[model samples]
Target: MYTLYIANKNYSSWSLRPWIMMRELELLFEEKLMPFGNGSNWDSFRKFAPAGKVPCLHDGESVMWDSLAIIEYLADRHRGVWPEDAKAKIWARCAAAEMHSGFTNLRSTCPMHVGLRIRLKAISPELQAELDRLNELWCEGLNRFGGPFLAGEKFTAVDAFFAPVVFRIQTYGLSMNTQASAYVKRMLALPTMQQWQTEALREKWREQGHEKAVLAAGDVLEDKRMQP
Candidate 1:
């Protein structure tokens, strides 16, 4: 059996990637949730993760860390983790890789907290540029490969890569074009996404640093999901 180690669902965007991928693919694996905060969790995490990060996969004797690397490893073992067509596969890989590497401004300015609904006081010029680029990338993939998902009608690793972005947009009430908005709705409505959000809302341990930054930027919006 495979074992997947992850951090807090509400704040660890990196951990969500392989998680949603495995869940959506209906793969069976044991989940080890390690909430981040102090020295003890860090020490435990380091034993399984060489980089001292969450979302590490333990497949028997072999341990694989890094979200993208874990996804690729699962893809090799399972079908539909990525698109099947060669051309579509290439396009999906490019978009996923781009997401894996770029978009620092958005990631930094608007950290994802699935349990909170926040309204940013201001969207910085750099952040807006990143959002614009993200919209273009989404549109390009949707139009190029045909709609309903990033690469096609079926969900792929590209979609999993961008899943955290959808959460970021919804949680912070960020704006997007019509197509992008529709896509976000579809992503959020996914059963796996819903499951993650529900689990996140139930988490009691809040990352004090993230909460402080978000509260300073804007007020937390009232929502039923925010209620315990």
Candidate 2:
């Protein structure tokens, strides 16, 4: 069985990537949650994560550390990590890669905090540009591949990669094109996403770093998590 080491579901956006994908695919694996700054042993995480990061996957002897790497590893061993169609697969990879490497503005200005709803202090020009880009890309994929998912009919790795963004969008109420907004609603309504958020709300350990970053970005309108 694969052993997936993650961190707090409330703030660990990277961790959420592989976890939600694995859960949606019904892949069996043991979860190791190493929450940030709450007795999170870097040495223990680095033992498998190598970079002291979450979302590390240990598949027997093979240790995969980065979220994107974990997804690719699953794609190699599993059948449905990506789309079945060749064109869809390629587009999905590109979209996932784009999400991984780009969108620094959105990633920084609006970090994923599933437990809180915040009215952002400001959306800088850079962040607005990135948000516009997000709408454009999502619309393109939805238009190109038909309805339901980024690549095609099924929810593949591409959708999983953007799962955190769904929460980020919710936390900030970031606007998007109508179709893209509908896509966000569909993703948010998923049973697995609901499960993740529910679990995230149940976490009592609050990381000050995440909290500080959040308040620095905006005013917290609501906090659904149980207090630490």
Candidate 3:
């Protein structure tokens, strides 16, 4: 059995990546939720996660501290972590890797807040460049590999990597090209996505740090979260 450590679904974008991938892969595992604590969770998370990050995976005595590492670890042991087709597998890895490292602007400007619908005051140039790249990359994958998942017919790691972006788009009501929009709709419609959002809404703990980013991004139109 594997144990996965995570943080708040509403705010932890990195945590969502592997957490959703594991669920979609139907890999049996236990989830440990450690919501962001007051001040830094650095000391606390360092207990189980080496670098004090969520989405840490414990496979018996061995531990994988990074999301991409865990994804690859599962890919080694599981059958469908990445696409099986040669070209598709290559593309999936590259796309997922790109997502792992790139898109800093989107990640920072539009932090994941699943329970709120926000209307942004403005999209900064940095964010706009990233968004343009995002749409282009997504369209390239969908056109080359065929949809409803990036890199193929299956919802593999690439889709999981972009899952948080789906929520961000939903939160800020961001626009994309037609194909990318359809991809977002498809991803949002996933059963796993629905489950993740529902749990996120039910969470009442509001970490001020995450809230600060939300306010910086835009006006909160609707908050689906439970009231205090």
Candidate 4:
């Protein structure tokens, strides 16, 4: 079985993808939790990954870093990580890439933290524009694909790619159109996602200042609070 090295379950968004994908695909793998923040954890993570990142997959002797690479590698080993339809496959790739490479403001402003909650304020106008574009993307994908997910029916890698975004959206209680809200609901309903969240909720590990994002969701952020 493949071995996955990951950071804290509560805050590591990248760690969630392939970890959950493996479960959804029903592929058995060994899970090693390296929980971030300790010097030793960084040392171990860097030893396995040249980039010193979490969610590193050890396939026998070969190690792969980055969530998308891990997902693609597993998809190669087992099908159904991506869509079966050719056209849908292309769009799925596009959506995944867009999610992987873009969304700077959303990521920077809203770090993923599972259990804690806080209020936020004074979001940048630029970030608000980014959020608007993201809403449009979510709306279009749901409309075209007829989704409870981004690519419609099945929970493909595309969904995994944006799962972190889903958490961010929910945590922030970001305003979304009907379609986007429905898509968020679909993602939340996934068994694998529930498992991830359950694990996250039970985590004792904490990151300084990340609690605010989680708390922000349930509470109202003042108009002046912003992450600098």
Better of 1 and 4 by TM-score: 1
Model 4 global lDDT (CA atoms, 0 to 1): 0.77
Residue-level lDDT of model 1, residues 25-58, one tens digit each, is: 8888999998888435667779889988898999
Per-prediction TM-score, please?
Answer: 0.95, 0.96, 0.98, 0.87
For candidate 3, which ten residues in a row score worst on lDDT?
Answer: 143-152
Q: List pairs with backbone clashes in candidate 1.
A: none
Candidate 3 lDDT tens digits, 84-159: 8899889888988898999998888888899999999999899999889999989988988887789889999999
Greater-lDDT candidate between 2 and 4: 2
Best by lDDT: 3
Alpha-carbon RMSD to native, per candidate: 1.6, 1.4, 0.9, 4.7
Which segments of candidate 1 are over 4 A away from where they belong? 38-41, 223-228
Candidate 2 wrongly placed segments (more than 4 Å): 38-41
Model 2: per-residue Cα lDDT over 72-158, one tens digit each: 999998898999989888889999999999999999999889999999998999999999999988888888889699988888999
In angstroms, give how far residue 80 of model 4 lies from its true place.
0.7
Q: In model 4, where do residues sit more than 4 Å from their true spots?
A: 38-41, 209-228
Error of 2 at 130 (Å): 0.4
- TM-score of candidate 2 relative to the true fold: 0.96
